[model samples]
Target: MPDRAPQPVDRQLPTDEARDLIALVRDIVQREIAPRAAEEEEAGLFPREVFRLLSGSGLLALPYASEHGGGDQPYEVYLQVLEELAAARLTVGLGVSVHSLSCHALAGYGTKEQRAEHLPAMLGGGLLGAYCLSEPASGSDAASLRTKAVRDGDDWVLTGTKAWITHGPVADFLTVLARTGGEGARGITAFLVPGDAPGLSAAVPEKKMGMKGSPTAQLHFDGVRVPDSRRIGDEGQGFAIALSALDSGRLGIAACAVGVAQAALDQAVAYATDRTQFGRPIADFQGLRFMLADMATRIEAGRSLYLTAARLRDQGKPFSRQAAMAKLFCTDAAMGVTTDAVQVLGGYGYTQDFPVERYMREAKVLQIVEGTNQIQRMVIARHLAGPETR
Candidate 1:
């Protein structure tokens, strides 16, 4: 935030172990991520080696079971680590989230044999992953995806395109949702497809407003053959599984939103305290101070909202509605906080000389991804109104 390495987040971690984990994450961010973030992001370079370093450090597996090469930390802890990484660079933090999302189907619903065969390597094997649900025609309406998976001789030939896929071009594995039966949600199914499978290729990464370092592309499965063993859940169960992963994945986006907002707030505060006004520091002015206060308040509220949802998830409670709410509120908060950060720095913020401009650009995509804030509203309203009547 200060251009120099910012201090720790002063988090209220659940355990001493979690505190240590955050410290390690902060150190890594300072050493490996923060310094290179601006330059590499400008160049649109994906740091696969950094991801490997994360895998080797045990940071990649925090939310899963230790029995299967995971760190076994609860969602609460896992999320804060995401926040720290995000503070340094959104690409890395969101990359980790998508990796976890790609792994969710197998971890939550795979056969025990499937879990045994794949979970360990996926959790900590230095493998990058992608989740493919959004398609060219289907965005919020994931059940409408047209990707087809036709059964043949104990294999399924997948054919269609998955759009806006994070890590699509370079992922080592993908958790893909494809149509396996009749129309609508009941027809969908999930598969764990290897990225290198024949006929599975990625289009060029999209030119985007933010997080350019994170490749977002369309994955084409041109009669890509996947063994029956690679299926994550029963046929016609993919939509449900996709929703399940999104419930958790939305939380990851929420945490990343807070991290970005917090980084902006830190930057704004640092700028306000140093830059002189008519006579004294601009931070001494009532208007700027109020803005900073509001920024900090929003960031705190966002952190709380996501953490509450994370705790509910850890406790095995129904948290889908809460997750949507967190994703909605926190990401919107990030958009506002980052915009204000740029405003706080004025012209300097607009220039590439400061990182707040980048933060502002990055905050926008968070609102659109996972689920748009409009979609989140629909989710919350559905929970409250108990679905619309015909």
Candidate 2:
């Protein structure tokens, strides 16, 4: 079956500008993205031109400062835009989130000169970006990353490997975290490195179950030289900056998760209402009706959870715990809702004919990325009952 345009979500947006922004996003997605999403994803083709289009449209920099080519929108508005994009295609939505995450360290902690020199090109010049924190040996324990950066007069020579980086091979820039001191979080530092810098090379992209359109690869930095001016924050502050980025990144993932669930729910509802059995529409059956109702409820709850966390962030309040909860709940909800969507489609859901099976596969990664759902639980626990004692 051909892909249907998703139903527009009814949102209580904060302002007319926010509403208009979402309308624009929907128009772009319908016209430019959704039609090609399945075919490109099936062929594992990353849509670089779509990203360039988003950059030119100013959709790629919605949550940052206006002085530096960003839209200066609040987190709440930015996230809704993500939902709309994700509802159309996971690669595009999550790609936006990762690019925003890659920009976070420099945008938040860099000096005025650094911001002015780099932020505009990064935010709006159509330059793609990647975040480098995970190593082959360190996925969740990012503080223990062993990528080393040695100072050499006015430059730093970096040598290590970054694993599972989104946009790894195609990025125009990288936000890298490398150890500059002793072990653990305090020893690390953040740097903004040019993606094509000498000695920076990406391994082949990973073969994945879903979101194949987004390349995930391991980057090798073999004596990649970066100037001292490229350092994002003080030495030993990289891990802190990474954690801060992940706090917001988690919310981005949460919004994307809700988008995926909403998309799946939309597909399920359409299928259920039109698909017939016993000479009657499946919509007449209570069993399927209850399933559809539950799916919609979960999507609503997940949307509400993420938005509540976003509101806390926009107020400049401490929202780490809320972010964690939103990430955990929203992703799990995506996984469940997508699975139920497949069930609603019966045998067709198991095939590649419908998108729900792909939705199911795509939903799985959301629980595992940003931070695993288990890690999100630990984060929430530390906020609630305090950290666990060794």
TM-scores of the candidates in the order shown: 0.99, 0.99
lDDT of 2 by residue, 1-390 (tens): 456677899999999999899999999999989988888889999999999999999998999999999999999999999999999999999999999999999999999999999999999999999999999999988888999999999999999999999999999999999999998899999999999999999999999999999999999999999999999999999999999999999999999999999999999988888998999989889999999999899889989999999999999999999999999999999999999999999999999899999999999999999899999999998988997998
Off by over 4 Å in 2: none
The TM-score, computed over Cα atoms with residue i paired to residue i, of candidate 1 is 0.99
- Residue 337 lDDT (model 2): 98
Count of backbone collisions within predicted model 2:
0
Best by TM-score: 2
Count clashing residue pairs per candidate: 0, 0
User: What's the lDDT for residue 276 in model 1?
Assistant: 98
Candidate 1: clashing pairs of residues = none
| Per-model RMSD to reference | 1.1, 0.6
